[model samples]
Target: MAGFFKRIRAGLNTTIGFYLLVVVLFWLKTYLTYRTDFTLGVSGGMQQFLLLVNPIPSALLLFGIALYFRGKLAYWLMLIIDFLQSTWIFANILYYREFSDFLSLGIIKGTGNVQNNLGKSFLEILRPGDFIVYLDIVILILLLLFKVIKIDKRPFKFRYAFSITILSFLLMFAEYSAANANRSGLLTRTFDNNYIVKYLGLNEYAAFNVYQTQKESSTRSKAKAADLKSVQSFIKKNQVSPNVSYFGKEKGKNVFIIHLESFQQFLIDYKVDGKEVTPNINKFYHNQHTIAFDNFYHQVAQGKTSDAEMMLENSLYGLPQGSAMVSYGSSNTFQAAPSLLHQAGGYTSAAFHGDVPTFWNRNNTYKSWGYDYFFSDSYYKNKPNYNVGYGMKDKIFFDQTIPYLQQLPQPFYAKMITLTNHYPYELDKANTDFPATQTGDSTVDPYVQTAHYLDQAFGEFQQYLEKSGLAKNSVVVLYGDHYGISNNHRPAIAKLLGKKSVNKYDLAQFQKVPFMINGSNLDGHIDHIYGGEIDVLPTLLHLLGIKNDNTIQFGHDLLSSENRQIVPFRNGDFVSSQFVKSGNTIYDSSTGKELDLDNRQKKLLDEQQRFVNDSLSNSDKVVYGDLLRFHKLKGYQNVNKKDYDYTKKHALKQLQQSDRKHQTSLVDQNGGKSTVPDFKTNAPELK
Candidate 1:
């Protein structure tokens, strides 16, 4: 035992042994970070093994290059390389702590609002335990200081460096293969960043993110005007006339769009433990003033919530990969809902979200979309215990925004985004009166509780609107942004949903999201119309009595008699009342059985395919080619994003200016007294 200790100490004093020590330390740091810090789905032995091995190649590759250099230069290079890699890992850890998402080049460029708002309090995300990540560096510096392992004097042989590089590359290849086998298409699929970091390492995920951003940038630049022709003709031919009965019924009324985050249609009247999951939303859905769609789905791609916003606001499809709002929003020209309503109805348009303005690049996107005002985290007083994952709790968010919402002029178009029900649904125990499901999956259990909380918040907001006299003359549109739980949680969800089994078809059906519109003048009807987020803007436009005859909208009016109910998903899937075409498999909508389509059915499927393809193609063309810049709608002026700013100071100045410019502001009308009450919630965090 004494001899073994002496040998180990002697070996560790060498340069090669020190390099190996660095690699091992990196691996340990990653494991500790993955296991304790972030929820990277490191469950079974297989996943644990993947996490353990994935960090090997990156550490080796980064440090191995230092072997080629000599003396102090070599030692310094190794330290620098290790530090750079560590920085990347540390950045991801911080970002993932807040977003439950990995950092990317595009996100980095777009998160100015986050940096500016949170920079002063950045220590909030760190913990004393996280200092372990730097312990290895400290040890190395101490060793050099104490002369335990002096810098190597010999020049590193070419063969040694070459061999190390080759070994690192091979290990990396093996890691990719293993991850791909376990999580099919780990390299190619439109997947969540968490999955990538779980199976493949943070370093690899960063590399992939850079590559994807560059590829998207390349595609955007290469887009041509000629590409717009097919999509334009297809859209023109598929236009549906608006329903005369519902047409202009709520014309010039206030539009209040409530964006429900991570909400699904399944929770409308769903009962868990014999208690309603979303009672308030259910009641509102069934109210005589509400028109709810039973078969509506969210067709968001990799962008998730942001994609839904892009489609709902612009009547355009999100990109095939990554967030369109983040990737192309600043550069693209959009004739979106805010601009359209402002131009057509003399309406003041504003969007209220209790999140970082730079989230999804919304600050830039909203400006480009011609929003008169945007109330984001900068405008919100995110007091202690007020905010949670993503942003402020839904109740607090709604309560705080009422003053701003009221300040908008009559016949206004405003969107309020809720945030409590976001993914990996977490709520303080004190707030949760509802019992969790015994699904053994933590994500599946809280899904209902947070949704219930959201429902209560909505009910409170609705009551406030009624009390303020805004409900009578307003069209309140409630929509689910995207699916809360992903396909990874499908099996557990299937058991909770009381299904014997679930497949791709069942997973596709899980994408259904709630869409309800309530107004005093509009008649209530349960419409079984099949549509997606892309159809929202045009449908609202018709209700507001706007003529979209010359506008290039890809979606048809859901209220129209000739409404094209064929909804296209971003991932080459289409769903309607008749059938669901997902990838290569077709399924009967009414029955869950597989379809053996006859000649007529096949021909219809082909036509639907063309329509879906052409629609997506055209929408992409509009975004990629900046087509809207060339074709200005009559009466609509070009939006100058540079003219608008959503900084805290600027936002306040604009609000005050609006108060002065238009005495119609509710704050002025109420003699500077706020109509909103302090927010109250059952959340344990508040207690």
Candidate 2:
């Protein structure tokens, strides 16, 4: 053992061995950071294997460059490489903590804005253990000081260095080919960044992000106004008229949109151990004052919840690649719900989310969308006990926002986003009264409990609204933003669902999310009309007695008898009442059997596919070209970017000032007090 140790030390002291050592150390640190810090979707053994092998080529390519030089110059170059690489990993760690997203070159361009927005709170993003990433440099410096590693006496050889560099590149190409074989077009196609990082590595994703950003930028520059004509024409031709019975039911009523994170339709009446998972929502769905859609699907793409938000607000499809909020938000021209309602119906608009203003760039995007105020994380008590994975726990979020909601002017459009039932679903154990599932997967057990907790919170909030008299004149809207459990967890979820087998079609069906609207004037019925997030804007606009004609909305009123039932997903897949098309496979919606489409069916599918393409392309052009600036809609007023200030302090102050000036706010009418005490909840966190 002593002899082996001596030989190892002797080799490590040599120049070549030092280079290998530094490269290995760097890869090890990055791998550890990936496994520990970021949720890069390492769910199974295959993903873990990929994560292990992914860092090899990048580490070699980076550290190998230092090998071409000898002595102090090479040593310094290796150190610089180490510093830069570590810095990249550290930045990603901080970014993932806040956004649950990977960094992109386009987003990083706003570094100054991000830093300025975060202020001192940015320091909170750093964990104490993050300092461990620098320990390798400390060890190396100590070794050099102790004369354990000395500069090599040999002169540099370019031929040897060049061959090693070539060998590294060849190995990378071979590995990439193997990965693509496992998942076809793995390298070429743009996918969710999680898949990229899971299959490749962070370093590879950075390089790929740069390539994608440049490609997209080039496409944007080449986009022409002529691109707008086709999209506008298609929207105009396909637009549906509003149903007379539902056209103006909720006109002049306050709008309260509740965005439920990760709450799926499957949980509507689902039970485990004889206890309902979402009892409150189930009751609300069947209420006489509520209208609910059973087959409603969230049409979010890579942006997930943010994409759903964009689609709901703008009646436009989210970008196929990345989040429109993070990618095109600052630059895009939106004809959104807030702006449209304000201009057309004399409504005031505000949004409440218990998260940092910049999570999805809502701080900036809301301004462009013409929201009058935004209440973000600063307005909430986001302590660890009150806050969970994404943001504030549901009970606290709802309980605290009553004051702010009361201060909004009459006929206000307000949105409140809840966050307890987010992905990797976990809740404080004391908070849940529900029993666990018999399924062996521990990961699936907590989902029901958390969802139940969210339901209870909602019930409490609903009672408060009714008691406070706000429910009399408010249209309360509820919807799930996107899927909670990913396909990777489908097997376990299937077992819990009592399915013999679950396939992609089953998964797609499981993508159904709850969509409901409750109001005193609404004649509650189970509307079988199929719709997605994009259809929400026009549907709600029609309810407010605002016509969507002459507007650039791509969706139709769901209440319309002529509402289009075809729903196109972002990935070129689509679902209709009769068929579910995924990639090249077509399935009968009733039987779930694969179908060989006849000529007529084929033509219809092809046309639907083309419409999907044209719609997406046109939406992208509207965003990229800022075409809304070119055409003025009949009643729409151009959103003065200065109409809103997004700071929580400023927003609250504005609400206070409005309350004083008008003295007509609900809180002022109730003698200048908060109604939070009216809310009741069984949330264990509050205990």
Candidate 3:
């Protein structure tokens, strides 16, 4: 037994063993920071067993230290391990805070999909000072231990160390087994961080628990029946239907809804190299029925692209903080676009994207959204590939969509999302298919080239519409999905545009995208109104002579003659007109101006908070249930579009009263004594 013990000690003292130990410790730190304990409950027996064993790599290092201590070597390796671990922990802490803030404000829910350049930019803004502070703490501890601890007399016995290591390894294995007990079953106890606290230390477990609880609570509250009911009541009592008196005077129009991917308005620049980079878009903006929404902002959550799409199409609430596309897609209960349109106006709806329908679970969501047909990668053949993983070129997507447009029955709604302008925008060198127009050594220049290509494609699609005889009747609306995140090109873009620095908010022009409605029958006029992707649905419905009886829409029609209120969801807050922006000064909406700014700002902020809370907490009830009940009561088939006129007037009157009441109450709640003067209570007469 003595000989065997000695041999084991000798084996562990090898250089390879020391490196392995370090590697194990590094991996454990990563797992602890990134991997939520929630998985322990989801997996069946074998998977749980594996997860429990996942901590073995972390535990082994403590034992390996004694066995492989060549004093100096051990010290350096430990230092390196500590440094890496500290960095990872610090990064995670920042990410967690940002994610939590975003969730609290309803900007995003808490799925950790920060893949875009804008995502990186947001991360950069996330507490850099806090990260530095934590890093300093780690350094201080390391210094104190290295200088003060006397290691010469410290006990380093092989048997004792081995025993502890074995014990830890066994414990980890047991934990893994517990995690894998049942894959499909709701193993809440095992998965919950609060439960894990029974074994893990309080600090580690608490960090995860706080995050999880908030997320779960938020999601449940949003999807709750009571909340949905409130929204429905509010809508039924407020929303006004547009009169169709002018419908026959105006020609039947073509509507083009372009959902741009990660576009931000901050990216729009008038000149580059003394030449306009986006001249066509600028011209369109100047000439068309353009509504320049300056205050419009994107509240991207975990499933960034999908969340934007959902908010725009369905006006449905977002997922719980932690639940994103991967998890949300697994369920079929979420509200959707097509169903609402079909119910409201009998408009034939279709969805189009330039990728696999399965990506982001759009296939499932689109089907649920009530789209009669969906065009995806499967819909096209013999198309030139963009050489990226997602799908074919945007040009192809647009070109192919033309055929489908011609065939779709009249009074149809088509949603087209393009993709060629996606990140890593390099023209393929190997394929001779799409000839390169511009070439440069810098990586970012390719993205510019790609953007140019996308612009050209847009122009081509417009030409196709005109030639195919669809221009006179169709209405085309285009906008970006989110801001592009490629960091390589930011500096170049800034330099080209003559900007000081390029950040997420500054890239708002990219998010600004192009939202224009052009049809031969439509007048060429510009409407500089603040709006967002969420408003698109209501606006379109209104334009099509469709009345929205659903109470869940948080958005109002941009064309409506009401006082425009634009609210952009950012991380855990909102950017509104009330938010004062001056020369580089970002203020909390309330005190954004020099203390003397209108007290109404405070009321605005409070109103926004109430709006978000009410919207989130009662989404399903407000959006679907109340509307459905109302429709059912009146008889869905029996009531024609004319029936909504009285409801519209009544709802509009109630909404105005409610808005005033909310404003007054919110201001009072915020400790402000200011009172809003009551406006005329008379409702607008429908033509």
Best candidate, lDDT: 1
TM-score, candidate number 3: 0.59
Alpha-carbon lDDT of model 1: 0.80
| Inter-residue clash pairs, candidate 2 | none
Question: Model 3: residues >4 Å from true position, as ranges?
Answer: 1-224, 233-254, 266-269, 288-295, 320-326, 333-335, 382-386, 429-445, 486-497, 501-511, 580-600, 620-687
Ranking by lDDT: 1, 2, 3
Ranking by TM-score: 2, 1, 3
Candidate that beats the other on TM-score, 2 or 3, i.e. the better one: 2
Candidate 2 lDDT, 489-597, residue by residue in tens: 5567688779977876887788889899998989998988878888889989888788888888887788888875888787657888767886556888778888889
Candidate 1 residue spans exceeding 4 A from truth: 1-212, 218-227, 648-650, 656-661, 666-674, 677-687
Structural similarity to truth (TM-score) of each candidate:
0.75, 0.77, 0.59
Better of 2 and 3 by lDDT: 2
Global lDDT of each candidate: 0.80, 0.79, 0.48
The prediction achieving the highest TM-score against the true structure is: 2
| Global fold similarity of model 1 (TM-score) | 0.75
RMSD each, Å: 6.4, 6.0, 17.3
Deviating ranges (above 4 Å) for candidate 2? 1-67, 70-206, 215-227, 381-384, 646-653, 656-664, 667-678, 682-687
List, residue by residue over 202-307, the lDDT tens digit for candidate 1.
8888888788777666765676667666766777888888888878889989999999999998888899879998888999999998999988999886667788
